[model samples]
Target chain A: MMPLWVGPVARYMATGLVTTLALAVVSIAVSVVLGTLLGALLVLPSRAVRLAVRCYVEIWRGLPIIVTLFFIFFVLPVIGLRFDTFVAAAIGLCLWGSANVAEVVRGAVQSVPRGQADAAAALGFPWRQRMRYVVFPQAVRRAVPPLVGLVVNLTQQTSLATVIGVLDLLQASQRSIERLTLSSGATHAVPILGAVLVVYFVICLPLTSLSRRLERSLQRA
Target chain B: MTAVDFEPGFVFSHLGPLGQGLARTLAISAVGTAGALAVGGLLGAASALRIPVVRQVIGAYVEVFRNTPLLVQIFFLYFALPEAGVKLSAFTVGWLSLVLWGGAYNAENFRAGFEAVDPKYVEACRALGFSELASFRRVVLPLGTRTALPSVTNTLISVFKNSSFMIAIGYPELTDTAVDIVSVTFRAFEVFIAIGVVYLGLVWIFSLGAGLIERRFAIPGGH
Candidate 1:
């Protein structure tokens, strides 16, 4: 049979899980779109643009995600840019996630053989058509596995929103532990946090395995 | 509310605490890297040797740790373990989590390296009548470690970066130090930017050192 705390804790955590999913979904979607743009810009002929994109990617990716979130949530208000906790966390995550995805995209695009681009040029295709018809399709195949890995990482990282008090899965479990301990006078951290761990494991393990499988197949190809 | 003026130099005035925090971060990262290497090396070698149930156990360990976030693992170690009567200090929990997480990734890195060791070398060692242990120590160890160096270096850098997560449980690392200063001074921009630069510098130095070692130990005529 189930314990009394199970029902209440699950109910509380379900709401938190929804928030976590929303944050992850928004961050992932925005980052992928922005990062792909930054990545394409990284390969442009203009040295200044490439350098600017490089700095953005390096700076954001180098900082800890927590610091990024804190800077957004805590510091931005000092400069008159106020954001809600959820919005702040989402923006912070997008900055960091996009930087990582940008690197992956850059690497994937560069990995495509130079000969592919030259062949398209030889066929009298313009630069846009060459990249559109020839390069991106091949690059997309190479990029998929790493992109999936990034999604896994971004999902796991959404838990960090708890630090900024975003009521994520981890935060909800913390609240549950507190309420249960207060009422029952015994630590219920194990079951609640254990459930939290299981939740994350369930969400991430399949993606991780899928990424590995894709990587293996890519290597064989 | 009145406009909050940006004080870009505010963090510079509190260099003492930030320096202490830097030391703590470096110390924890150093110790964690060593522990991770030891644990990962052993587990990876065991997996390479294919020791019955041990291999499966190591596989499971790698998957579970890799699949979960480092933050949650830290919470489990800090918050959950105490319920089982295994109370540990926050500092203990900080580096322990890094070691555990980094060790898992490193195990996978080392296993791939060991598996990539060309079989002809093993055959050559065997034809010379060397025992399994000696051959592993002599030939496979050197070559495998070379192949593993790139990925292992990545995990090591991640260990340094992840030490920032210690702030959640208040371990007084660099991020924690910055947070404390921010609370008192309200100079979030300066504090976060300063610490971000520090972390980037640390990562840069680490990668540079790793690159040097990679060059020094590079296998002749092998990519």
Candidate 2:
């Protein structure tokens, strides 16, 4: 793929690609866990917890990821907290991902048939046990496709981390473009950004298609 | 490009500038979503009217937008297309890009709406000697509009959210302006929270407005 484009630029992109994946993978893990907790918190019987969770999800979803990234990158250091670029990128992506996941979780939980929960309760299954043992497993299955789609989105959102000087794929291309086209007249933007696009496409397309496949499979089931 | 250390008083002093960006954010999203709904409805209806050429053209356009990332689409409009001789402000590029991208998604919503219109109604109109346009206007459009609302609300919310990307190309929108302030002050948490609160407040207002409209329009005992 690098040879198909430009060797040196492609090589730089390949190296920078690691930073992107790190942001994506760590961000995804943290988000899913946070989302699950937030989702569960919202569905709790306590009105206060539910209200708080609902508010958190709503506020996060409405806000833009770019805005959040800026906040993460620029804000914390002023409050006597400083995280490096990678950590900031991870935290920013995590915060954004969690909100989307919470929505997916909420939808999936609702999608579970009413009878299953009722039946589980009738059989003397405790509420906590029922959710943990019965309802959640099924909801997770239903949630997978949308969750995948959310991840695909999250993957793209990670590109915004480049704005914080993270040196992810997009930032790498920006750097090379500055060097090649603008600065030295030796490097190029089209190939670099174009190459970044394909790398992104390669990373994202499979997950998106997989999400579709899962949806179809579930439909068939 | 100036990065600074975070401090307490920074966000308070800059809060005034940030509030102005929120107005721009709302304006861009509202105008863009409205434009998208209009274009999407027309395209969706045209595609479904059994006009082969029109259907093909609309279908292809939708496919192109739906498959690509919105950032690339925005970049193409803001940077690339201008080189092709059409110059537009960054804001115009932002608005038009969302309108195009969101409209494609909206078209699908409207297409589903069109399909959901009971064919029996169309047939009944035919029996009553209603013209095709009359039947569509009186019967089809109303039902389609109602059926399309909930789905389009999703797109509407998304249009608002994605409009933030307009900041990337220097659209002077709320998010972009916030980034500038945060970059200068390095007060990340406060500015982020401030932006989040503004967004939450707006979305709440939107949801409240949506509820009012839904209630006003809801059919008694209607799904």
Candidate 3:
């Protein structure tokens, strides 16, 4: 049988769930747009630009997400640029997600057959036109599977926002557990945490399976 | 901001402690990678063997670990495990969690590698009088390991990065050391940036090492 506070805890987690969803959506949107641009730039003619973008990607990817979260939430204030906890968490996730998305974009774009681009150029299409008409159509199809995988990853990563003091799902659960224990005089971490874990499993399991299925289908294609 | 505002000297001042932290990070990552590889190898083999129950279990593990945030897993072990009368040191818990998490991903990588081994080559091994286990150990493992190198490298880099999550449990790894220095010096920007650079350097070195291993294992014109 569930505890009396289960109802209250569910209510509490609902709010946290909302926060998590919002964080994931905002971060995913920002990263997708910026990362796509960065990915496009990665294949540009200028070696210097490509090198610089590569460095950016490596730096963001190399640092731990937690470190990046701390850098944004804690370090930025020193430079006189401060953001709220949610904003800081979003920026950190965006930076990390964008770097990964950029790599996916670069890989997908490059994977497009070279002949298509050459033919487009022969037809007097400019670089942008070639990407728009000839390259992206094929590249985007290839990009979808990995991008879906990355977005799923970003969704899961929204949990890290708790570290930055965001009242996301995990943080809300912790707070609820503290309150419930204090009021009801029972230690019930396992059940509550188990429930929380299951919630994550529900939210993410489908997406992960979808990602794998997509990857398999992409391979077949 | 002025040029002097971003001082490189801050990093130099904290080099001793940071170096110690970096060493710990390296130790954790190395041990974690070794543990992951061991577990991943077994799980990968199990999955590839297609024993229904074993495959289902490994599939569950891969999905769970791949789906959830590493932070939650760390928290569950660090906070929840004590309630069940298993009081592990923060370092031990962190190390084990890394192995558990990284192993799941590595298992998938290894499974893919194992499955990618050409059937013809495996048949040739059997025809050459190698037993099933012997064929797998001699033929499947080497080829699978080679095939899995790139994914394994990616997983290792992630394991190294995830090691920073040990800070949540108060373990004094590189990120934690950076946090400590910043609290002492109020120079969060400089200290954290320096730590980021350290991580970047470590990842670069790790990738280079993996590249060398991949080359060494390269199958004569068949990369």
Candidate 4:
């Protein structure tokens, strides 16, 4: 008997896996960059900018990822901002991911002792110089492990794209199961879903372990 | 596709069905939170006690659940388990997945809480002639629960938010109801905005309750 996943089914699932990875990479990249900027802005002296960024973070973080995905995928088009399924999913994921990343960034930056900034000021360093040379270097070190943890989270969250009709790994698996069941008159959901779970476990476990390890090492340092 | 029209009142017209959906979401979230706390509390206590085989099993369980997406787990229980001669309704799958996922994270939270219990307290119990189990019950449980409260609240709120995923399996929760309304009314913007506000309001309530409980049980001058 030919193996079920060895032929076209395998190829199809591989394509889906690539899409999942692409979505994750795009979301992570955009969120991390955008979130860092937002996080920096959150702590600025300007009350208006801080309030605006805080509201954005709180509102986005407060909602579920699926709701956000639906809003971007379905609601946005109605407002004359149409995107392809992939782009819509990516945008939704990025918005949520960045909100969370911003919190992590804000927390890390805030955790730096006030004395450090005060001392920098005493040295005649400007706000930009103090942040660049003193505060941010320390904040980046504190942020690395959580940021890594967020990568794992955002990667797993890419699964949400399947709900928005993206042909991600989970979606691919579901389609494969449907086709296989129809063709063979037997359900393959057991093995197929099992494979999807295992695939996610494999991809995420190392990152989870790495994040934990980084956290432990950082705590000691 | 037409003009930018905002109808904030659209959702109120469908409040009857939406209210029922909110009830279902709350029901599942409440039950899931309780069930997860029970499971996590037991596993956490067991691991803390260092039962060799059980600790290893719990470790593996936590890693597996925590590392994978909850959506995939829902699909697994919903689709794959039926092939194994076990069947569950969509609602069962919904809350069960939450229990499993939240339980795993809560296990870690509770374990950390238990570990954070001051060793000095355990010593005090022993000095008073308390047995290991007695000391654990009399001293560890209460203090550890206090420490665990914040993270537990976080997990519970997650359970509440995650109930939204049940929409995929057709459980007719809040998100599902909104989606249904949008499909029929073609009022995607209004429906989603209203739903988003409802969710934000619920989450706010959750955190507010958590704060109250935390303050109520806080040890005097304790961090």
In candidate 3, what are the lDDT values of residues B1-223, reduced to their tens digit?
6443778787998899999999988888889989998989899988986888989989988888887888888878877777788888988987899999999999999999999999888899899998978888898888888888889888988899889988877889899888888878888788888888888888889889989988888877784
lDDT of 1 by residue, B1-223 (tens): 7866767777779999999999999988988999899988999999987899999999999999988889999999999998898999998998899999999999999999998999899999999999988999899888999999999998999899989999989899889898888888788888888888888888888889999999999999996
Residue-wise C-alpha lDDT for candidate 4, range A38-129, written one tens digit per residue: 99998899999999999999888999999999888787778777699999999999899999999999999999999999999999999999
Worst 10 residues of 3 chain B by lDDT: B1-10
Which candidate leads the pack in DockQ?
Answer: 4
- Candidate 1: which docking quality band? medium
- Estimate every model's Cα lDDT from 0 to 1: 0.91, 0.78, 0.87, 0.91
Using Cα atoms with residue i matched to residue i, what is each candidate's TM-score against the true structure?
Answer: 0.95, 0.83, 0.94, 0.96
- Residues A1-221 of candidate 1 have per-residue lDDT tens digits of 99877897899999999999999999999999999999999978899999999999988887878888888887778877868899999999999999999999999999999999999999999999998999999899899999999999999999999998999999999988888889988778888888888888999999988998998999899
Accuracy of chain B in candidate 4 (TM-score): 0.95
Clashing residue pairs in candidate 1 (N, C-alpha, C atoms within 3 angstroms): none
Rank all candidate structures by their DockQ, best first, as comma-separated numbers.
Answer: 4, 1, 3, 2
For candidate 2, the per-residue lDDT at A217 reads: 98
Off by over 4 Å in 2: A1-5, A132-134, A183-206, A209-221, B1-16, B48-53, B82-86, B116-140, B187-190
TM-score of 1: 0.95
TM-score of chain A of each: 0.97, 0.92, 0.93, 0.96
Candidate 1 residue A106 Cα shift, in angstroms, is 0.9
Tens digit of lDDT per residue, candidate 3, span A71-124?
Answer: 888767776776899999999999999999999999999999899999999999
The alpha-carbon lDDT assigned to residue B167 of candidate 3 equals 84
lDDT of 4 by residue, B1-223 (tens): 4778888887789999999999999989988999999999999998887788999999999999999999999999999999999899998998899999999999998998888899999999999999989999888889998999898888889899999999878899999998888888888888888889999999999999999999999867887
